[model samples]
Target: METTPAPSNVDPNRTLLLVDDDDILRERLARALAKRGYAVTTAPSVAAGITAARSNPPRYAVCDLRLADGNGLDVIAAIRDINPDARVVMLTGYGNIATAVAAVKAGAVDYMAKPADADDIDAALQASGDTKPEPPDRPMSADRVRWEHINRIYELCERNVSETARRLNMHRRTLQRILAKHSPR
Candidate 1:
């Protein structure tokens, strides 16, 4: 529930709502955005976040896909309910196709996996809609794809290593090794 107070230079009209259960991550992001001239309001649960948005809907929002009380999609709905033009980004540690689809359906402007930094979030929020979608300049490396797939399965299995290993038909030790390594770029 603790939040960093906005400085005098921040614009009162340009509010941002950040909803996440992780205390450390929430605080860090709030400070970063506040430094960038936003008046940031933070909440740890769906109800609190919705209430904050209803009171003074933010122009921007960053919501975690999973919260202690409910899904972040609910927060998205609340934000959109008050400010249809509000830009929202959904964050998740367990990135997957299904959840990503759900996020889009719920009105998120973008979806990002965990380990995303403040700069990344900021960039997504500020990206203009005037550009056309283009094909990637380069395809992802096989290793990167494999790493993402493994992580997705692990998350779907509720972080149970054994179950994930079995589902992937991978050796338990091999799965452990992959999980232990940093995600491939």
Candidate 2:
């Protein structure tokens, strides 16, 4: 891992654990967070995350909702068990109300969808009690919102295109085409 000099305003409790299955995302986020002055430890699976937390519980954590080995909720639970004061944020590509609620229940301080910037993650980790973060200057566009909704529904349907299309009242081909395209910014 590359090293970066810590910023002057770095928190005293700057240890952080970042767990995500996506290699590219995990490495990128680790580097970004490191540059932001966090002493970041990266893990690629729930087991690894749990082990890391047990060995050295961090002051903060950012975990992906879905992982190949297990759910990120389990990681949150472990961290909370080891260090109740540790702030945790959950991230997912399949963002939905149910999972968000689950994340909060699992002791996460915040929940964000995937593609969350490093600044946002840092802000969330540093947020104190009862203090809310500022709203985004520009929220998702209508098309992006629609795409996210469709993807959420698709995930709910277990990635069954036919069922998702039926539920959305969209033509199968149209839904397929939409799903094939990349998500809007």
Candidate 3:
């Protein structure tokens, strides 16, 4: 879908909220974002982040999908309530396409893995897409989530079916069954 550009010049009125469970990373990101000319508020958990967003909605938000109290979606929802126009981004270390798709479905302008730089955050805020795509083309679905999870586990296990199955809380036979059902001959 087509997108518009947010103002290139940083606006003082456009503040940012940085939400992550990692204290050190959150502090570092907060300082970095502040230096970039954004008035930033940092939160250590989903609940705290939601509280902060409710108090004063930010124009931009960078949130970790996994948080101590809950998922970042709750924080994103709070921000939406406070400021529907705010651009939200989900930053996660568990960089699975499934989660990224889910984040976008949950109202993120975009979703990116962690260890991202300021530029990534900037790009996400400038994206004009909504939580869901326009008609016809839809977001990822349950089958995608399951397949993604299975593939991720398999990758970690170096394609060892037993190991992947154990980690996924499924039997080896079950994993094999799914793989056999899904894999191309």
* Best of the candidates, lDDT: 2
RMSD of 1: 4.0
Clashing pairs in 2: none
lDDT of 3 at 150: 82
Runs in model 2 lying further than 4 Å from the true structure: 1-12, 145-183
- How many residue pairs clash (N, CA or C atoms closer than 3 angstroms) in each of the candidate models, in the order given? 0, 0, 0
Which candidate comes out best when scored by TM-score? 2
TM-score of each: 0.73, 0.77, 0.63
Q: List the lowest-lDDT window of 10 residues for candidate 2.
A: 1-10
Model 2 — TM-score against the truth? 0.77
Residues 57-134, model 3: lDDT tens digits: 788999999887889988888888788888888988677878878887777887765555675576557656643322
lDDT of 1 by residue, 6-113 (tens): 888987776889999878889899999888888899999999999889887789999999898989999999899899889888998778999999998888888887
Poorest lDDT segment (10 consecutive residues) of candidate 3: 1-10
RMSD of each: 4.0, 4.0, 9.6
Query: CA lDDT, every prediction?
Result: 0.84, 0.87, 0.75
